[model samples]
Target: MTMAEKATDQAQRNTEIVLTAMRELFAEKDITALDRYWAEPYVQHSPQMASGLDTLRAVVPDLEGFSWEPKRIAAQGDLVFTHSIVHGWAPNPVVIVDIFRLDDGRIVEHWDVIQDLISAEATVDGNPMV
Candidate 1:
């Protein structure tokens, strides 16, 4: 394969790994699994809270049955953008747009915007916003 093709393959694999890890972490609430995918200096930005990895670790326990499904993903160079539907108590289905910056195959930074999916008008094509 060409260099560009190889890079694309690597990026796609990395994205899948990240997504899978996130799903497992959410489903099982296993904070220790985070170390396998998240960088030491990871930063996360959320609608309700913006904090570092430690704070997120602490706050995860308060959340009940959090889960997400990625609707789309786009990646360029070191950055990957994912649009997903997040489900939890705060909102039945929250539309979330997350941007992840990866370094050395690990997620080092993340920023996200979450909006509650209330009425059908809030989405497009009669589907939840993602």
Candidate 2:
């Protein structure tokens, strides 16, 4: 494989690692993977979450009714973006686009854009959000 191909393969693997950990952490409520996959100076742009890996670990289990499942994931270099469905987080399901910056195979920074999945009646366009 070419050098670019190798880099792409590595990036894909990194994204896969993050997605797998997210599934385990969110769906299974397993915080054990946090320290292993995330760094101490975790920068969180989402107003709902705090910084630090410890904070995430502490907060994960308390999200009793919420389940975040990744619908699509893509990565380039050290950054990975995932579109996910967040069920039970609100009265209606929410679609979230989460972006993460990874270094040395661990997550160092994060940001997200979340939107409530509006009802069919409320939506103007006849298209699904997620």
Candidate 3:
């Protein structure tokens, strides 16, 4: 394969890793995904989460009625970003931009921007949060 093709393939793999990890952790509430996809010394930048995968293993199963709907994803080089809507962790649905950094196909770092999904009526421009 050409260099461009190889890059594209790697990007796709990275994106899939992010998506599958999310599905396993959030949708399935399976901690095994952490071992499968997360690297040791995982760096987390989300204010809500501590800087390691162990915290996730402790927290996910207790989340009542949690649901994740991934709206979009993109990947470049070693980074993947996912835009998703999550429910049950907060009073209102949250829109999140989750960025993952991977090395050798294992996620090593994460950062996220999360905001409560505002109602369409609350928006001055009438734009949806999704």
RMSD of each: 2.5, 1.6, 1.1
lDDT of 1: 0.76
The parts of candidate 1 lying over 4 Å away from their true place are: 121-128
| Structural similarity to truth (TM-score) of each candidate | 0.82, 0.89, 0.94
Q: Write the per-residue lDDT of candidate 3 for residues 13-121, one digit (tens) a residue.
A: 9998888988898888888999999998899998888988888889888999899888988899999988888998788899988899999999999998999999888
RMSD of 2: 1.6
Report the Cα lDDT for residue 127, model 2.
73
Order the numbered candidates by lDDT, best leading: 3, 2, 1
Model 2 regions more than 4 Å off: none
TM-score: model 1 vs. ground truth: 0.82
lDDT of 3 at 52: 83
lDDT of 1 by residue, 52-85 (tens): 6787688777887677778998887777888887
Worst 10 residues of 1 by lDDT: 121-130
Deviation of model 2 at 105, angstroms? 0.9
Cα lDDT, model 3, residue 28? 89
